[model samples]
Each structure stands twice: as structure tokens, then as C-alpha cells.
Target: MKKIVAMVILASVILTTAFAMTGCSDRVVLNVFNWGEYIDESLIDRFEDETGIKVNYKTYDTNETLLAKLEAGGVSYDVVFPSDYAISEMIKRDMLLPIDFGNIPNFIYIDGRFKNREYDPENKYSVPYFWGTIGILYNKNMVDDPVDSWSILWDEKYKGKILMKKDVRDAMGIALKLLGYSMNSTNDSELQEAKELLVSQKDLINGYYGDEIKDMIANGDAALGVTYSGDFMDLYWDESTDFSYIGYGVPREGTNLWFDAMVIPKVSKHKAEAEMFINFMLDPEIAFQNSNEVGYTSPNTEALRRIREESPEVFELPAYWPDDSIVELSEVYVDLGEYKTIYNQIWMEVRIE
Candidate 1:
């Protein structure tokens, strides 16, 4: 769900059946599990062709869902894409395996700020895929005022015209931010206040959604809602000062910048092949194609340069060309354990209210 500002690279396939005869005994095929529309279809084909190893492309909606499936240990998958906080949880549970950085030399192209992040300190396990901040994406015509703050979501005049996400870490995380608490706050009272605010504002919502928020907004089903920054470009509008105006911003206090990264699962059968696929994605050409196709930021330095050069138009978008204040926006989110439960309970209260 972190893909509001996401994208990936392309690759050619390589199918060599050396010690990889059986999916169980040998690791011939690499199963990649990630979010829908998170990668380029052409890249998958290229990976299959270049590796000669079968590429099993799968998708999941949330990090929680992906973690649950992996924890069940019912399937054999080599790699997975998970958000910043979820990566920490997996690392603590020892569910992830350390990467052989030697196999991923293209990783050298990544930006340093996204590397060795707190959740992935030393970045020994995960590699950043795409990242984005949480903010309200609203139609400029409907919003009526500048939307540089989170308090606007609670305005009474906007009653029954908002769309909020069903996910706790996100929707609730925004609610917490509006209360002037840390996005990573562990305080019980601060969380309780956020819960109350959500409950009060729930009725103002026209709908609660997940992936459909884009289509809904494009069709004018709602005025504004909490959304990932990456999804803002696709919402809806016309050539004129027309159908809608898509705008996004991190709140004044700050916002959560979440990154989804590719990681190897400890139970993977194709560790080597999985690493190859990751490196293929790291290739600058692949990154350029992936970023251009997906409309998200590339953590790959070289790929970003290509994107800026060829498609100067991509740079003109406000969400893509974030304001200087975005630098002030902090990198934070609630942790994995019990507070997760507290978040879920508050979500339920907001939903049922």
C-alpha cells in the first residue's frame, strides 16, 4: 500500500535449469510477491527470458496480508516487497534472510538517503523499491483553500464528501498526525485522542476504500480523502481547467514517508535467482522504463536522471516535484506489536460509528 510514489525497473529473462530441477529441491523458479500494478509486465517477461528460470509473479494488497501468507509457510516464494514498518517486524521475527550484496551490484545506483534507513539500518536485508508520504489528495476546485494542513480533513463544510482508507497504519496514522503527535508515538493518551477524532469524523465520509479510491475520485464520487502521493497523478481531470484538480501535501507538523523494499524470505528456494531479479531491476534502463510506466519516484539515482531528462513533463507535477517543506517531513510510522492492535480497534470504532 506504500505505492503512491512507487515504480520499478525492467529486465530480460534467463532460464538456466542447472541445479534448479525441482521447485522444492532446487530453486529454479523465483516467486515474486508484491502489490498489484507495482511492476512492469514487460520486465517480468524479460526476467523470465533472461534467467531461463520461471518467474512467478504474484500480488498482495497490504504488508499484513503478505506477512500472514509467508508466516503460514504454505508456499515457496523467493522474494517479497513490504513497507518500511513491516520490514522491521519481519527482521525482528527473523523471517528475512540477509542479502548477498555481491549478487546485486546494480544496487550501487541507489540514493544514499534511502539506504541504511532506521528500519533497515545498514540495509543488510531490504532494498528500497518505491516510497511515498501520506497526505490528503483533494480536487482543487472542491477544496476551496490551500491544503497544506491535515486539519482540513475534519472541516464540517466537507461533510459526507471524503474518502478514507480502511488500513490502520495509514488512515489512522494520518489521524494521529493531525492530533500533533509523533507518527511513531507510543503514547496511550495521544492515540486515544486520535481514535476519538476519527470516530467523530467517520460520518463525514462518503466511503471507506482501498485501491478503488482513484477510480472513485476520478468519477467525482468524493471531494477529498487520505491517499498515497503516488496515486495523485491518475485521479482525474481534463485539458481545460476542467473536470478536477489533483493536489497532495504533507501536513505542517510532518508526515510519514514509507518505502517498500525487495527482501528475501528465509525459506526461499531460489536465493541466487531472486538476487538476480533484484539486480535486473536495479539496472538504470530498467529503472527508467519502470518509473516512466508507473509514475512513481525511483530510488535509483541514474534512473531518476533519465526520467528527468526524457520526460521533463514528469518534473512539472507538484506531487512529483514536492515542495521544499517535504524535506522537513519526517520519516516515521507506528511500530509492529501491540500498538498495531490498538490501531485496528480504533479503525473498527471509526468504521462502525
Candidate 2:
């Protein structure tokens, strides 16, 4: 009887080992890195459940931060979300892998206007995710001035109540646009002038913030802030927020018309799984859910139509879907290449000052 029991225990151990090895070999894990608060978390769970592909997700605040991590070369991310200029930089460095459109059948849902953009002209390496403009979000009760141009940010009257983005490219772009220069200007003298403008406005700036800027302005912690169109719209449409007292405007001097997209990194181990996830995100119903939850303008044409149909009031707001005139005035950011170092130096000096 004792011998029989020992044999049974050995068989149990062998079966457990076999089961563990089988599970380990069959499981597929995809690592996704994206902007903070950019997606609906529920969709991630749903994707995992449907595909049986476990997702390891993480978030970063700035595109620069995302670029740094990708450059650092230690960690591996299967999928990443980066803005237009950043995508250009990555493609220049051969950091991205060309996507297989055959696997992404839902790519048909993306709006034609968003495709073939300058950053990825052929639409080979990236998939358009969200698009918007940078602008001022101000509290009407706190400031009586017209918030039509970038110059209003430097007004002395709102001195201690002003906010700027902590992001280098965005803040610098604002200064560049105000100087009547292109936001993508690579001219050293023009960049220097923009830098000086930021330095001059530094004293008036209450603080430099990131995603928290939306909440800060919403809570009336600051009178005015430079923020994304989508960030302002998110709060504007929220039932809990007082919409009557807040306003958002794309400055007349022009602003950054930015596009953030998804790409598979060359470092990706599960390229197929990454493509699957990208395709899943592009599904019309899933895209609508994400766009509605995050309050960003979806690049998915079907999703855009759904939003307009479901929330016609959103389209009524100029800031939500700017007219063609505003589109003509706005400029998309492009890779500055080696000139990025100068912008970085200028930003550091402005912050330290």
C-alpha cells in the first residue's frame, strides 16, 4: 500500500509539470504603452477575454518620455502610441516596424483626411488614433479678456493665474506661433526668438502641468491654461462640471494640429498579437466606446459619425470639431531632427529660470 501511494504522488507531480509547461508555451502576452487616460480600460479587458491574449499595459505622460523609454533600449514594448513628429523621429531611426495592413482589416474605418499625413505619408508604419489642436482653456468668470490669440496668455492682468504645458514642443510651439513663425520652424534665430518669448512669460506662468492641467482649470485652480482641445471638451461635456463658466478657443495665431497614432516597435516580440490589438481598437463599436469615454476626436470615420449622431450638441461646439477655416490656420508638427537639442536646451533654461 505504501509503494502504491508513492507511485501515485510521482504521477501527480509529472502531470502538474506537464500542465505548467503547456500553459507557459501556449500563452501570448502583448505589452502596450500609451498616453495616460487615453483609452477606456474596459476595452482592454474585453480584448484579453476575446483573444485570450494577456495584455501588459502601461502609460506615460509626454511623448518625450515615451521617446526616451524607447531609446533607452532595456525594456521591450510590443505596441506604442506616439504623436506625428515623434513617429517621424522613430521612423527616421528605424525604431518602428512596418504594419501588415492585411491583419488590420478595420483600417478601412479610419477617415481619409487622417491618412497619408506627412509624418507617415504612405501610412506604412503607423495607424491614426486621435487628432486635435492645442488651445487655451479659460474660466469665463475669472478673466474678462477675449481669449482669441496666443498673446492673451502673456497679459499681465492674469499674471498669477496662468498655466502652461510642461511639454517642451507644445510650449515652444505656442511661442513660435505667437511670433508669426511656423510651429515646426527649424531656423535657429526663429527658435531663439521663441525661447526668449517663453522666458519673458515665465514670470507670469503659475505652473507647468500635464494631464492634471484639465482638472486644475476645471477646479478653478488657475484662470487660464494652455491645453489640448480634447482635454477641454472632456470637461465641457461632463455633467458634473459647470459648463456655463468655462470656454475653449483655438488661438487666431494658429496652434499645433497634432495626431497621435499606434505602431509596433522593432523590439516587439509578439508582432501578430500587437496587430490584432490594433485591429481591435479600430473596430467601429470599440472605437466609439473609446472616443466617447476619453472625449477625444476619433480618427475612425464610423466612430465620428456615431458620435455626431448620438451627441449633435458636441458638433455644435466649434472647439469640438473646428471649421475648415481653423483647420487651414493650424499646422501639424514635423520632426525637427537634430534641431530638437536646441529646443530642449531652450526649454530647460525657461523652466530653470
Candidate 3:
């Protein structure tokens, strides 16, 4: 029964029993582990139909979780969607395979800004999947004051009414940003300071969570929470107009600009097939459909152009893409290496508090 429920929720795409006998008699399977609810359900079925590749989809809520699974070395996956820092760590650990761009002709559609990024400087280990900034999502009716700074989360008036991210990097990154420190700070003293601040705010927080924050905020379970830009947009606009009371903004103190990218694991047996899957997703129509369903910024220029031309109104929403000022102020996290153990210890202390 648990397996049935898991299949229903994750919506893993298996070839229909009939298709297994017909089109997929010799099907190749592509195992994908990604963030939950990050892709369009229809796209999985479509990919299976067109390519005869069976998708065995799984999801993990945090980059750490993904890393742990890959490191543990029990299961094998063809492709994974990991954030920028995770990709950096994986490359350093020799966990990923270089992408063969020749098999991915649709790579030309990706925006130039998304290419040759710091995480995979040579574009060898990863392909940009979705990109966004971290920000505060608040209920307009519940919060009376201006909501433009990271300090608002620490405000005594809003104590016990805040939702904080459960993930380490994001949670500590917020504290670091609040202190005017870099989110990717390697300085031990600075990391310790952020840890102390997070511990101090533990009592004020309603709970720590992952993607459930979207539903929790929309349903009024919490007045404000730190969330990805795309999650805020999906909840505030796409989910229901009733959630119009919700607002998203990158704090004046700045935040993290994050990118989740697709990569082939070194252990993957289906390298060429994995490249085929990446190329298929980069097609303009498919990319557009994913952007619309997932409510995240696509790295594909053609897809974004089509979206803007079709729905001129989305541009009015600030959450679709942030202003240049915010983009300039925001920073991306890099592999902390040995310093990550310090972060883990600090994060564990915060959780206990």
C-alpha cells in the first residue's frame, strides 16, 4: 500500500503494460531523482511516448539528501537535478560525467547568462534546469509593516508565526544574509555567528519545512516563510487568485540566487540516453510547458520568449523574475568542501534548539 501511494504521489512514468509489449519491448530505462513537484507530469508521459525511455522518477527535498543518497551507493540513477553548490561538490568528488553537447543540439536555446556558470565553469558536468532567488513570502493581510528586509523574520511581533526552511544551506544562508555576511561564507567565526542567530530564532519559528511551505502559506498555516521565488509565484498567482494576499520579495539585505541543473552521474549506465532526455526537455514547446506547469524561470531563451509573447501579463508580476538590483545583490553558494562539516554541526545545533 505504501508503494502504491508513493507511486501515486511521485507519479513515476512506467510504460503502460501494453506499450511494454508494443513500442517499449526493448525500452531503455532512465532513472531520475529530482526535487518533488519540480516538473510537469504530462512531460514524463510525453517523453516516454516519444522516446520509448521508461522514466523511473524519484524525489528528494534537499541537496544534502540527494548527496547522501548518491554517496551511499546502493541505487544507480541516469540523471539528477541538483542545485549549484551540490553540482560543485559532485564535480569535485568525481561524481558526475561530462555532458556530450553534440548529442544535445537544443543546448543553443539556453540563454547565454545560464551557461558557463561558476558551478560547472566549462559546462561539462551539468546543464541549467531552473533558476531563481530566495525571498520572503508573506500574507499581506497578516503582516502590517513593510516586508523588504531579512530582519522581519526576527521581529518579535511576528514570533511564533514564521515558517523557516528546513534545509541547511538555505536556512543558514538567510541568517548569514541577515548579518550582512556572504551566504557562501567560509569564515568559521561568521558561520558560528549565523548558527547562533538561527538558534536564537528557533522558538519564534512555527516549524521548519520543505516544499510543503507552499501549501502551508497558501492555506494560512503561517503568515510568512522563506521560500524560493518560483514557489511563491506558484502559490500566489497560479494556485488561486484568493492567495492574492500573498507577497514575495527579496530582502534589501540580499539573498541567494540559485540554479538547479541536470547532470549525469558517473555511475550511470545510460549516458547517451540521458543526453537524449536533456535534449528533449530543451525543446521550446516542452520547455515552455514545464515553465508554465512548474512556475519557475526557464534557462531556455526561446521558451521564455514564447511565454512572454503568449502571456504579456506575467511580466507585470515581480515574482516572475526579480529586478536587476536584487540580482546584482544576490550571491550563489559554492561547494564549501571541508567547511561543510562545520555547517552541518551548526545546523544540527540549531535544529536541537
- For every candidate in turn, the CA RMSD to the true structure comes to 11.5, 4.7, 10.6
Candidate 2 local Cα displacement, residue 179, angstroms = 3.4
Clashes of 3: 0
Per-model CA lDDT versus the true structure: 0.78, 0.90, 0.87
Residue range 1-353, candidate 1, lDDT tens digits: 34533322111112234324444454377899989888888998998888777888899988889999998987988989998888898899899999999999999899887898868887899999987677777776677877778777788888888888878777767777777777666788988888888888777788788888766766667778777777775442223434346666556767778788999999898888889999999999998898777778788989989988887776665566555466356655636577777777777877786
Prediction-by-prediction clash tally: 18, 0, 0
For model 3, the superposed segments whose C-alpha errors exceed 4 Å read 1-27, 44-76, 192-216, 237-241, 347-353
Give me the displacement of residue 254 in model 2, in angstroms. Answer: 2.2
**Global CA lDDT of candidate 3, please?**
0.87
Task: Give the Å error, residue 346, model 3.
Answer: 3.9
Worst 10 residues of 2 by lDDT: 316-325
* Model 2 C-alpha lDDT per residue in residues 42-154, reported as the tens digit of each score: 99999999999999999998888998998998878999999998899899999999999999999999988788887998999999999988999999889898888899889
